[model samples]
Target: MAINRLLVLFLLIINCNLYFSQEVVIKDDKVLLDGKQILKAEKISLAQYSFFSVKDDEEVLLYKYMDNETPSYVNDDFFILNFLTEKIKVESTDLGKVSNFMNSKKAMEKIIKWLLKERVINRNGELNPDRIVIFKEKYDENITARTLR
Candidate 1:
């Protein structure tokens, strides 16, 4: 009876760990967000409208579509750099153009510079890298918040 009870206990612990683990896996070139294999890009694009965990995923899209002010949290290091949202803007551009903009190093630098100039991100001249949760729509006012911790 004692041995049987110990085995049951061990199994229970293992099951609990598996239940709460947040590892996303990718197989066959498909990305699995929290064990749900994303078979199509449409699903991913739709899912981008909602706030989701940023673990094991290489890229994320944030959608902001409301006009109410919301709270957000940023890493202290990033906060000091002032990389928070004061305003957001979206443009009527194609996905290809948007993708190119995001991938362009020069564009990214310009964005960072603009953010620093506007006091939206760190301007202390020290790079305090932290994950930033950003809303996709511009001037929508609704802010979705997330934390790396």
Candidate 2:
């Protein structure tokens, strides 16, 4: 009877862990922010983002988003970075905060172009670091008060 109870408890733990899983993907060159792709940098150097863990002291990376932020913990994709290293490393610390600002649909449509400095595209899109300032200015122009914690 005790062994049966232990098995059930173990299964419950596995289910809970699966429930809170999350991910950050890096594809092509652009970081896929939210369901849509955003933020085109000249070349991503240190492409990494840090978030808080559900467990205390023990840092949970790779598969943890945050409290009340996982609209689809198991299947939602957001926030992409750039890098290709087989080794996986996780660390615990007060990384910082991730916030999303509301914007108009029109602004959203031109986001990629604005991020790429409104440059003419040919075979592949080019990035201009100088235009990033303009992008920030434009982004701040259409920000809303609402933000996720």
Candidate 3:
């Protein structure tokens, strides 16, 4: 039983290390690699997926795999749903804003606006308006919620 527990712990550490090694983080609406800016997120468009494509389930699965391998902007609950209905609307309330950045780019934009309203970032110009990737959320509690290094 002890050996099994140790094995599981080892596997967990190995999995975490894999993600820790290669990270793609969002900083000031720009994509960063190894703590350096790479792609300008806001300047980029959603119509043309410059990084990962989520056209089909297979592609989404690939994204999930890639997300597992790298530091993720997306959490386990991340999803993208497209539909039109009166009941389905962006939550305009400011009280609870967690998991707001999911489903669609439009939703992400709305979340960004909300974050801006909440003063999460000085301006949209200074933060990723769509996605923000960090290594681990719990590990970065004091983090300004903008630039994650």
User: Comparing 1 and 2 by TM-score, which wins?
Assistant: 2
- TM-scores for every predicted model: 0.23, 0.25, 0.25
On lDDT, the leading prediction is 3
Task: Please tell me which model should have the higher lDDT, number 2 or number 3.
Answer: 3
**lDDT by residue (tens digit), candidate 2, 1-149:** 99999999999999998775322223443334334343332221222332211123222122222223455452332332111121232221111222223222222223333223344111132333344334333333211223333
| Model 3 worst lDDT window (10 residues) | 57-66
lDDT of 3 by residue, 1-149 (tens): 99999999999999998875534455565445456543344323332122221122121101111122245553422222111111111211121332333333433444334434443323322433232222122122321222243
lDDT of 1 by residue, 1-149 (tens): 99999999999999998886444333443434455543211122311222122333322223322212233421221111122232233322222222223333322233334333333333222222332323233222222243322
Q: Report the lDDT of model 3 for residue 97.
A: 38
Q: Considering lDDT, where higher is better, how would the candidates rank from best to worst?
A: 3, 1, 2
Worst 10 residues of 1 by lDDT: 74-83
